[model samples]
Target: MTLSTRPPAVRTSLPARMAGRLTRLTWIDLVVAAAVLVVLYVILRVGAGTAVSFNPARVTRVSTDPADLPYYAARSLLRMFAALALSVAFTLVYAYAAARSRRLERVLIPALDILQSVPVLGFLSVAVTGFIALFPGSSLGPECASVFAIFTSQAWNMTFGFYHSLVTLPRELDELSRSFGFTRWMRFWKVELPSGAIGLVWNGMMSFGGGWFFLVASEAISVSGHRYALPGIGSYAGTAIAEGDLGGVGWAVLTMAVMVVGVNFVFWRPLTAWVEKFKNEQSEATDVQRSLVLDFLRRSHWPHALGRLARPAAEVLGRAARILGTDDRPLSVDPVRRRGGDAVFALVAGGLIGWGLLDLLGYLRDRTGLGVFAEPLLLGLATLARVVVVVAVATAVWVPVGVRIGFSPRLARIAQPLVQVLAGFPANFLFPLATWFFLRTGLSINVGGMMLMALGAQWYILFNTIAGAMAVPADLREAMDDLGVTGRLRWKRLILPGIFPAYVTGGITASGGAWNASIVSEIVTFGGTTLTATGLGAYVAHATERGDYPHLIAGVAVMSLYVVGLNRLLWRPLYRLAETRYAL
Candidate 1:
């Protein structure tokens, strides 16, 4: 009767069907996209470093006037976030590769250990020259170099966190993916990513914090006796430090406080809340993570519109991905065949490593002689002592505080913003005043340097603890409650076990951070005076400042050795224990 009234419905053509199915741009989506485009346009036009002629002699005009601090702060944040984006990209790829195969993991983990230990200055030594050459005559060259240096500070921690997540992925999630016949892309997109999301977010925050820690060094790049200071809060603060302007430093701190608050509200809070749903909680979490920004955005249609727009590209990539890896199938290989292949690979890799070591030894012996190794080894020991002290102190102070904050949603809401701000409070911010105070008190550099190192590395511990505590299953907590577990008993059984893997991840990065930070922390400057501790960091800094490449290489080499050895001997074992014994 309806068809008769409508004079018979005509069959839709393919094009007509497609047109009907197409997503029409909603008003809200258009509004959101327009706003986003405007902000992007602004970011590209000016905030993305000005392109200037490649001048190796260009000296940045760092103005310390409070009037100029806002723009300077904005520039610094732009560089930071740019680097953060790159770091995330690098982490996804690198950590995935390292996690996928045992053979690769063997090499990659050690390489990563050394990489994270390489100080920011070590990166600048090569990055500045290389990037400048690459861009030829663009301000973007040095800006890229600065961003890359910040990336060096941020990427490794994120990579390690992601790698840990991949390796420690629960057995059930993997089985679920396989049972559903998910393609590799689907598995990674749906199961693996969600499982890792919590750790990755927290680690990303720590990585951001590390970027802020090294901002001064990253922005104030020195190569071949020429200083290329970029227009940033770091550069502004450096100028203030050079002039002994405590007021200027104070102003920089104030600006950073404001910036941190804004970043927390705009970026991190939304991310935290968004990741909360991805969390693998066993029973309903009554204390939900919430963000006003996330809530507001959920009310808008932009994200869905964007997702729809991206669907075609995603489908193409998914097909490409399926060609390489199995569609969530259990990979069965002949053990003998795999072993044979692995052995051949190992032999070739071993040969290359041996050759490289021999070459390095030859070069070092010809220049500084074999005896050059002795001093750095001793200095590395000194630095190691300081690292131990710093980690111990940090673990003692922050574990309870972080755990308490994590378990209490109300406290977490209040404390997270503060921690985010404080975590990013660059240790260098205190160098002028703290250095002055230390000098005034006539304290040993060992005492003062340990304190400064703690300022940088302790946040790693705190961040991981909170992430770990939040991840504890609600059902487990309920069970503990039913069993009348209290205080130490609760901590010993559930809390400690739940948090162990995360703590190990944090500890590894924190330890590495301390080693990396020693390059800045062990060498303090105030006005025209420089105070140096008798440690590998001081040696590396002294070498870099004076253009002594041979000693610099030796100092860096020894430091890497220390880091890699410590990781292989201590951290890696603990990591394995965490994976096996404590993993959810």
Candidate 2:
């Protein structure tokens, strides 16, 4: 009865305060931050000390010692990051342009399908010489070539991801942005980007994995009798395989694993966690991922100080954007001008196609003889059959598992990084191992090659399905549970439909990746032993090795046609069905 009518004074225990501070200093956080700083220092030191002498004669110089692993890894990472940065920028621009223009979308989507199907080896064969010549007399030339090759490996799928996300933005939000009179730039930055952020981040991660998948071919390139070996883990691994040094290969694999783990900690994990804020769906089941490095950065006083230092530069950029930004208003174009532009575009495209066709036919008739084309066509059909079978198998296996793991936040958190690292394990590096096993077991190259292709491509389906499943709304699950929806009925009625869009996305990318992987998988070699499967991939690889440009071009063209045709005839229809029938 005698308690004063005033509030009690708040008190904080010293132990509690100490515990609060300690919570900010996790072991994982400290270790990641320290390792990252050390990596950056080494990268900068190596980059600066290494001159950019574009001497073609010096391009062959590379270290194979185990001690050089760290430096090589650092160099490889720099190229990867450079390629990734370029890929992101290309995605933003290309996806936006395609999304905004119906005319462009008609041409661009099919172009992308064909481009993605063009083997990485094809890019290496065609682009290496051009890139080297672009910066003649400088080491930056070959470096640029390698980075560009990785960029080709990484960019197409990410562009598709962003474009798909943009096209699939919720109708209500699209209308809202339009009603708010958002400018083109403002709409992109706020609406399109944030709407697409989740897919873009996931696909970006996959793109990086794809880059690593082809890193060896890109780094240790031999095109048109010109060999260039850029010092990197990829080159190290390639050399090990070439020398038949199993121990060296093991060491290279270990080094790659370390690099992948470090990359996940420093880049993907933090980015994945941070981009969760951009998700448009408000679902209790959609738990934002946590990253130790992100937590450390947020808690560290230096980052805040650095932000303050960067404020002026950011403001300048903001001002420049505002000043340069165009209005979002739609203009009524003159029909005459529009028709004229369309006609010109059509005429130029027709001429180019005609010329290309003529050249291809001439080469086929004169160099390859028309009779030889049948062989590749038959081989391509076999490869296509293998791709279809492998994709179906992967879908059957991964869909349910991914869905279950995704539904559990704890499990998803645990699995995401592990899967990311596994996906980044260059599938080609294991080719030698597979070859050895196949030789011992006397397995058919076709069967073994399909397995390798599946191993390389199935992660696309797995990871994307996990992402889709995790995004499922908590209320939907709860409602299904309350309604006693379980077993086949639950999946058929709720779960499968919920994840259909993601499954289609994964399926499309996986199929394309499988086609690309066929090039390496079908033509396996370890030291003196070479295993060649009867497929278009092996044909391309053989042609590449022999510097037979006409056959190589023919094989790549046929593969691109098959890929684009399949996407148009199969995947595109399925994608439409997903968007129209099952989109969440």
Candidate 3:
């Protein structure tokens, strides 16, 4: 018997082998090259379309023809990814600060609550004009504003997830970092990042899907008084709706689903599989996750060859990071000194908050007097009732389902596309049918509003639950199974506690997202009819449409006050419990 020593090769004729020898290109190389070129084409076309669309003197209109859906999908996807990049950057900085510093945590968390509660229209009302002024006649201004709006939809949930990951960082990892004498930067970049990676990726997927509805809405609803849409599928759908072209609208939605699946396949599925490298397990997952794209990349020659070429550069950068990271000792602060520092920070933060409040009050008083506060406050209560109900229902439903999916890698892989499609499918995609049902069934806007908000908000709970379930140690899972843990006993003894921290993060963010969604949910218009629910969102929407800036400001302020107070009263305590009792 004889064994071949050459690298794996596909069957080929003698002439093909001769051609490969002469050209220095194997069949595998050709296939890899084709794949690389296809990826590059998608990237370059997306970038070029986005760049050219931001012309100051030009006005772009969305095309509704089904044939144009592919191009529109590309543009919309580019915009969504741009917003996602911004969200990731913001989460890294903002969440890190909140986790590391007690003083900053107090201020930043509440600020996050308020920011998450502010709806898309509220953001656009301020951001659109400022972006236009900043860019000075460049259409890039409105484009940037649209990205920011989507960014808002994503950033807070991601930030909360990362922050939870940090605060609930496993004790073993912390001890290992201390034992290694790792510098702060090294600890963060190497240890903390991998620890949080799963949570961040899960939350990022949730945010992407959750933000899609806003992507479409932001197109038609960017400006206060008039429509300012960019060239994307969202705009295409909005244009169709405005023109009453049902066929065009249906095509736009089909295009959206395709875009979501494509992104999941190429970007997220690969990343999800790659993160498995960071898992801490004595035994590997029984059914390993797979991505065809990831598998090909690992098997290909070009990428590994490129890595070898870039090794020197990578080493140089690594050396630079070490040189820049001067702090090597673990963080240890004196209790008294920490308290003093917190006191100083509190005074400064309080002064800034106070000044802003006074300014807001003066604006309200001068415009409509103090009596104007009564309406928004009462309306806020209505919205609050709706939010509480939605959050409760979502938590009860998704927590168990997410746990089951998370425990099985095969199940998780299968669910990714289906979940993304569900999360990304905007409620308004079915608004016409819903409107007809609402009228036929005699359903009021109150119930309809709750349903609409859930479409966007519930995913936060599901994603966080999945992340939490995955975070449970492999050894612990095995022990539970060995002991014959099952059903309610299993959930009670292992599952609930393990996922508690992430569930808290999810619940808080979901609540805030529901509040943010109110603007869209509480006000419905279809078939030349308008249905307004008695909530804070309707109040804010009506005020914005009327160009009542001062009133809009008041409405936002009241909404923020309600959200902040609720967080202080409820979610924060649950988070503290997660930290003390349930953290891995």
lDDT of each: 0.86, 0.82, 0.83
- The residue-by-residue lDDT of candidate 3 on 1-584, one tens digit each, is 88989899788999987787658656777888897798689979776654443543444577788888777777778778989999999999899889987778888888888888787778988887888778775667777888888898889999999998899888999999979987666678778889899889989988998779787776665445656778788888877766667788789788888888999999998988887777666776666578998897877677777979998885675677678764533377899988899889889988998998898788778889988878999999999999999999999999999998888888988898898898888776666656677788989988888999898789889989988888777778889989999999998989999888889989998998888888878877665767789999889988877778877887888898898898889999999899889877
Model 2 score (lDDT): 0.82
Tell me, by TM-score, which candidate is best: 1
CA RMSD (A), model 2: 6.1
Clash count in backbone of candidate 1: 0
Q: What is the lDDT of residue 480 in candidate 2?
A: 90
Off by over 4 Å in 2: 1-40, 49-62, 283-287, 301-325, 331-348, 363-366, 369-372
Ranking according to TM-score, highest score first: 1, 3, 2
RMSD per prediction, one decimal?
Answer: 3.0, 6.1, 5.3
Query: How many clashes show up per model?
Result: 0, 5, 0
Query: How far is 179's C-alpha from truth in model 2 (Å)?
Result: 1.8
Q: Decide which is better by lDDT, 1 or 2.
A: 1
* Candidate 1 C-alpha lDDT tens digits along 534-564: 7999888878877777788898899999998
In angstroms, the error of model 3 at 33 is 4.5
lDDT of 2 by residue, 1-584 (tens): 69798888879899998888678666655665687798788778867633466566554755668999988888888889999999999999998888887667767887889888999889888777787777777667778888989999889878877887777777888889889977666677778898777778888888899889989888888776667888889999888888888888888999998888888887888887787677555455445578887887776655665779998885665567677754523535678887887788778877998998898888778987867667778899999999999999999999988898777767766877787778888877897789889999999898889988886689888877876776566778888999999999999998898778777888888989999989888988889998989899898888887788888888898899889888989999988897778765
TM-score of each: 0.94, 0.88, 0.91
Best by lDDT: 1
lDDT of 1 at 168: 89
